[model samples]
Target: MSLFSTPFDPARDTALVTGAGNGIGRAIAQALVGEGVRTVFADISAERVSAAIGASKRPELAVPWVGDLAELDACDALLATADAALGGITHFVHSASPPRREADHALAVDRRIWQQMHAVNLDAGFHLARELAKRLIAAKRPGSFLFLTSLHAGTPRNLPHYSTAKAAMAMLVKELAKTFGRHDIRVNALVPGAIAAGGVRRGSRAGAAHSARASRRGQ
Candidate 1:
């Protein structure tokens, strides 16, 4: 057996996946279910949330909730809902991001974009992880946190809001990793490239909007 054969058993663990409505978030939530881990699928869309649970393939251990995670209250609400549904959340996967269309670059991008991006991408992500870490640390329980960051974090795409939030998230991961490492809690960021996942779909209005926005940003 490998030295790191298993950090935790899926059957005994629970996971929370935000933005689980579609795309990469959907993919990850589905995979977690396949691993036999109890999962709570949360999104801002009620229809999508219901759809995710109904189509879970295995609803025995999966739950769904419509949540606006950008709202600070929703963060606590989600954790409470998950804890009630699955006893306790041992794993957290923050895949939810306030839609990052190819709009509002450094010049045209207003504070609106920055506020929304920072709220969901960095503030909520870090707060959730830190809050969970505090609980686990006090209880002397081991846990893991996985954040979805972008490769564009360090690189400049002119989307100051997005890039800045991603950078902060990276630092959040690093800080959490160092602070919680001693408590047996693992914190890591999944820096993804231009994968066809996320919220935007190709050839759709949203897709076109994103492209138009990006084009306006001078590619």
Candidate 2:
């Protein structure tokens, strides 16, 4: 009998990535599929989901799931769909967040917008990670989970909704990592700078805010 021997074998890994319709999420899904991992790409738009899967290096290895993860039901549906499609999830990535507009600042941001941001970024991240960890523990398998947080987690970004949600996510990462470590499930946050992608556009006020923060740090 032959055995597979490798630190991380892409061929045996199955991943589910949210907000994979564009930008950083899209890039991560593509990279996973390109490495032979069966990746399930979940996004809010059917069109964008299709486009992301189409653009993947290995379309066959990429599965498309479109849903609004901000809703609890939608988040549950996504997990069910991934389980049905992939049998078992080995890698989980929560990168989906509502578009953060510059004009949507602290005083101007609507209450609903604040709730939506936390629902998607913080609520969904916690639910998804917990559910995935449950399955991995049940199957006695080791897995890795990554949440797409931001540098704004520690620094105020002027956008209360976005910044606060990210800050909460950062704490969630630490808590999950500590609790799930015994189960061999690793949880972490991928804090990214201002990238001119889907939601974080160039020349936007949010970008300017990030730049200002970076400058202050440098000083």
Candidate 3:
């Protein structure tokens, strides 16, 4: 199959991807642009957003947005900007997440940290997806939504805030899919295993071990 092959039609698909500043989110956003799909690369850092778009195969097809999704206002602002830029987004990818720190484990994590994690992962995700779905339903357009969840959603990551938030997101995906399916809006989740990217610190022991296990499984 061709690298850019997808069910999406380039002429029809316009996408909005959160956390496009780095890691899997950046890769997904860039790939959509490469397939000739106009895409919004939304990130918390302006520098990262600019850099991600600059690195895209078709930079002209990339629109940059910088915002903290932890706030409801920012979520509303993003939907407005994306609609203005794309004339209505047909694809939505929720990959935005607060960086996870090893120190933010169950006991060590503060209320502020826990709240921010849920605010971005669960609250912002639901708000953005539902709002987008509403627009698509009103327009009578078929759309697709993808959420970047984690294998740790079910397993303990020792990071209660991250794991718990993801677990809720897994359920959110089911709830959204069931509700939006009749509207022809598909909702799904991508539960990725340990990768040495994004929030994963380079050369961390946990990363190395996971990589080793993944390689063994492949072999």
Candidate 4:
């Protein structure tokens, strides 16, 4: 009846968010829960994950899943958990990233930092997106996926590791978009500007933006 009205319901949909124990991931998961969507909080911190699960208003709607998303196998486990807990997921939010601070810029950056950055951000996102895409394809289901990217997805910051990963992540978004568009799956990155309050502020921004966008899409 309306341009924004969905024939299907979004509140009834399930959403999976990686790194949802704290910061951006936590915020995004909370937002999805606030929208009445079944939200799965996946993170490496069992304590924080449990806390988030306990803090939810609809505790039944917010399921906690703890694991290292950088490991591709974790995605399968998470999917299984979500499948059992919420039936199936129709949305995914990639909110995982390696530790970052102004102090970790190029002059002080080491190879380990670089590798960890790629492992957590770039590789995890690719693996999650790819695995979820395969599931959607095999099930003949359509879904939406959003990546918590930075403005660096276009312009580079002094953090070469973070910037390069974000840049590659942008390309990953495009690649997925091209491949999945025909299947009615939507893939896009949320590019946030410099939020000075650190990852907390960034997380809040991401949650707010994703909630607004999801509301607009009725998802």
Pairs clashing in candidate 1? none
lDDT of 4 by residue, 4-29 (tens): 34543664578899878776677778
- Tens digits of per-residue lDDT, candidate 1, 165-193, equal 98999998999899999999999899987
Residue 48, candidate 1: alpha-carbon lDDT? 73
Report the number of the highest-TM-score candidate. 3
Better of 1 and 2 by lDDT: 2
Off by over 4 Å in 2: 1-11, 201-219
**Cα deviation of 170 in candidate 1 (Å)?**
0.6
**Residue lDDT tens for model 2, 1-219:** 112244347656899999999878999898888778899999999998899899888899988898898899999999999989999899999999998877788789898889999999999999989999999999999999999999999999889999999999999999999999999998888999866564743356777777666556652
Clashes of 2: 0
Better candidate by lDDT, 2 or 3: 3
Better of 3 and 4 by TM-score: 3
Best by lDDT: 3
RMSD of each: 4.8, 5.2, 3.5, 7.4
Q: Would you list the C-alpha lDDT of every candidate in the order shown?
A: 0.79, 0.88, 0.90, 0.78
lDDT for model 4? 0.78
In candidate 3, list every pair of residues with a backbone clash. Answer: none
How well does model 1 score by local distance difference test? 0.79
lDDT of 1 at 200: 38
